[model samples]
Target: MRRARLTFGAFGAVTSIGGFVVALIAACGDDRGGFIQNERAFETEHEGGAPDAETCFLQCSLDGRSIIDSCTGGVVETCADDLACGAAKCQEPCAAAEADRSSNGCDFYFAMPRHYAPSIVSCFATFVVNASNKPATVSLELQGGELDVSRALFRAVPNSTDLEPLEGPIPPGESAILFVADWDPAKPRSVGERVDHTSCPTEAKPALEADFGNFRSGIGDAFRLKSNVPVGVTWMYPYGGAGTHYPTATLVLPVSAWAKEHVVVNGWEATLQGIPVTQIFAAEDDTEVTIIGTKTVSNGDGFTGAAAGIPAKMMLSKGQFAQIAQTEELTGSSVLSNKPTATVGGHECANVPTSAGACDTLAQQIPAFEQWGSEYVGVGYRPRTKNSDEIVWYRMVGGRDGTELEYDPVKPPAAPITLSAGELVLFSARSNDAFVVRSRDAEHPFYLGMHMSGGAGRPPKVPAYGGTGDPEFVNVVPTGQYMSSYSFYADSTFSEHSLVIVRKKTHGDFKDVWLECAGNLPDWKPIDNAGQYEYGRVDLSRQFGPGDSFGDKRCTTGLQRMRSEGAFSATLWGWGAYASYAYPGGMAFRKLVETPLTPVN
Candidate 1:
């Protein structure tokens, strides 16, 4: 739920700090101290009248404390009680970000998805693109389980002819990093059209898969990556490795994107393979996590003691993770943590629909609860097989009580629905279908996920337009999380690679948005409800494929970037034969609440 924001004070005040100065403008509110609410020098909320600048300065000076001149590196200045606290807290992260500017400048941790297929160790490949040019270094250590970390943790230098590291400092203006090891010489010469493996050496031991057995508790498949520079992370299963499923690669969000609360979302798990699993890894020590199951759930064998209304709890240290798995779908389950955590939802093999053919590996990172939005533009994936009428199922889960949902559809209309906290509504639509979901407001945000089952029977062994892909589940990116620009990869390994983009119709025409590979946007249709948003599904397969390896300036290859003058949301999809995968193209990851989030006491 969104919290109340403290309005500004009444009068404007100017202060000089170090070499820079900033002016903020806000409307008037209740009087605060001697300044108008909009013009307070500090954002802090004070009961009654706030302390005057001179008074706060005296308070801090009397304590023998000096304040940092700026959140960025700045000279020390005489402290004001009001500015002292805010400056002190902001300086910590700001200073750290500067130190880590060579790489992603935030906390770094990852709980990679577990893709389990029999007979093979399972190919779990992770790529980190050093987005910065400085000679930034990165280290990855296995966490969470008692597995053989030495063997499972791999270090790769993709550009090196041999498995040696880059001889000198890497160049500048680059934003990604790739690790390469000759794990296997006989594997496919290429993983997907997404990246060039022709230069990757083929000499190493077998690839390592996540330790699924340790998921019942904590301390298993999680891993932590540390870097001095800001970088982008990507995870792909069986891509370069030897496996047939887990078809897609997703842009991994950094630890700054992690949150304290999340709700699980996944495809149908009652398949011949393993069950669906929802996992969380803590970023701080002694973190407390609670799970409220939307259905009967268990980690492994017996019921986990978490049920529809009951909650199960766990204690974890930094880098530790907990998994809640059950054969039944755990879509509406909720997880609460005292500290920030990476929340993931996946299944060993899941059927897109109860009757779809060929179950495939399903994995997608679920966004933090605070990231869910009151509004969503939902679009269905194109059919891969002959069934042109492929239907995508959607589930909108309410985050709070008394949440009323309104659905504006481009096709068959949906009736309004009311939901209590944690409750969800399900609906089905076809490829051409587009809909908008709006709640009363931000406080009643909801989570929505999409599922694609084979049109009818089993998916064909070869690629088919309407007949493609087995059971697949992907989150519907909310309009609120939409970002203005994104750098993402597409594994055209599937015959079909596409993107669904949603933006406010009031903005400029499609030409304003530019794609690195595909020139000029195509296939745009205006959304009906209030004529507020327009949806587009761009077939970008030509941009991906056999060519386009490493770029001249970028440290990596086969990567694509999109930019727009306006804010928008997008989702990526790919399908080939019975293999298909989908996920949000990117996210804003901005804090939804005005107040810093605090754990429920």
Candidate 2:
């Protein structure tokens, strides 16, 4: 429901400031001060010449004082000697004064003079009056609409003359800032998303969850409206991405029992409102409140409270919104503190250090003997291998002779590490830190190992928690879930060949950690039994595959075809996360080595 009002002027000058209407006198027909009629009849009546006294009104200065001269809309009539009354007297309020239609339930209507002399500027001064005298508090907003401020311009002020107003009131004569733009009524605005405020009183706070799967990724949650009152909330989504838009968004929350509140659906930030820092309990539970603006005002109903009007506009969106599935609200605290409250195995197998001592020691071996349920453990390792070493090494566990040791299913609990399937453990003897080990099966006994660079007082810190590095053949009894493992760092400086021993109560097997300098080789051929090896070798070769490939596919194709004839095929899987060696030639996989192998000096 809108209407347009028109005013006439001399040359066509009009300047409107907020609610105040300040029309210039120069725009009037004859350069006389008067309101212009928005009617076609007024123009027809005054088209020919100046209007008579009955049609127009004029004011002038007589003796340094304002005086009403005449109503002719033309020149003032000179009085004759008989009717000479010099003192000014008005028969009624001057037509110019009465033309103010701001009050008395009347529309202003006045006709301008036909013409005026070339020397007078036209101007009209209008003011806003405190009609009810109700403290004269008027919020001079730009759009005649409420805007959210907390997340944007969070405050309002008017202290001294240099007041910078984001939004506030203008004293009496001053008009609010008026910003107008050409708007077509035919244009349709996009339909806003729906919001539900069902859990009003008890949970006045609306929880915001970001949905990244929609056309425009944004935040949303549902709430229960306690009463038919306006509601608004502010949400801050992590900014900066291809799909991000404005810094905020503002929308209206309808009066409903249960409403889904979706903020910033269009990707605009300015359009967003509500408190920025909301208190969330545990991890995913967000705080809800009814009153957004005022401090103390609630509906007082159980699970349904209503506060005073919120200071901002509430922006909500509909379905098909943004979302990230298969993830939980993991607040910062939950990531750092691993609180071990529950245990599934025979013992309280939680937070047990994966240090070699925890796994290697015979006394602490009971925990490793227990079984495991579905769980995950994080293990950080420290490597000290040299850059010049040709082989990138990993710490190894149970594998005896031709048979790989069976992991315990129940006893000797296991805590496994959560490394991506094929991610390799790059060896770097740079740090002096202990690493943890966990098994997927809880019953597998845990073992610890140590790495050291044989300095004076620094005999590498043997993972004493599990056991010391024992290069000598030591028979180990099958205890809990875990079996025996090489508890010492494989010395790169030793005979260049480490010895591996399989110790059992009744049977035993032993092999050189490497192809010994001069010794009886096992019946297993190095090349043929490579798959049964304790470790595998990685080489530099181009990485290429079926549809998508890298490197010189044409050149590598001949070698790939040659290798295809062998018992092995080229690896399509990408290399490890971190680089073990600089293979600018790309990634290539060779045969796995069962026992320790020697490096060609």
lDDT of each: 0.50, 0.17
The sequence of per-residue lDDT tens digits that candidate 1 reaches over residues 73-118 is 1334543422221212222321322321111233465654544444
The true-versus-predicted C-alpha distance at residue 158 of model 2, in Å, is: 72
Candidate 2 structure quality by residue, lDDT tens digits, 1-601: 1222222211111111232222111111121111122321111112112222233333321210123333322324432212211112222111221121111101111101101111111111011221110112322111123322212111112111111232342332121111111112234423221111011112111111111111111223222111111111111110110011111101111111111111010000010111111110011122232212222122211222222233222122221111111111111100000110100000111001222111110000000111111111111111212332211112222211121122111111222232221111213122211122223232222222212211111213332211211110011111111111101111111111122221111011222221111122223221111111121122112222221112322111101101000011111111111111000011110011122211111
Candidate 2 Cα RMSD after full superposition onto the native fold (Å): 39.9
Q: How many residue pairs collide in each prediction?
A: 46, 112
- Cα RMSDs of all predictions? 11.0, 39.9
Worst 10-residue lDDT window, candidate 1: 20-29
Candidate 1: regions farther than 4 A off: 1-105, 130-136, 144-219, 241-243, 299-304, 385-389, 409-416, 455-467, 505-511, 520-523, 542-557, 593-601
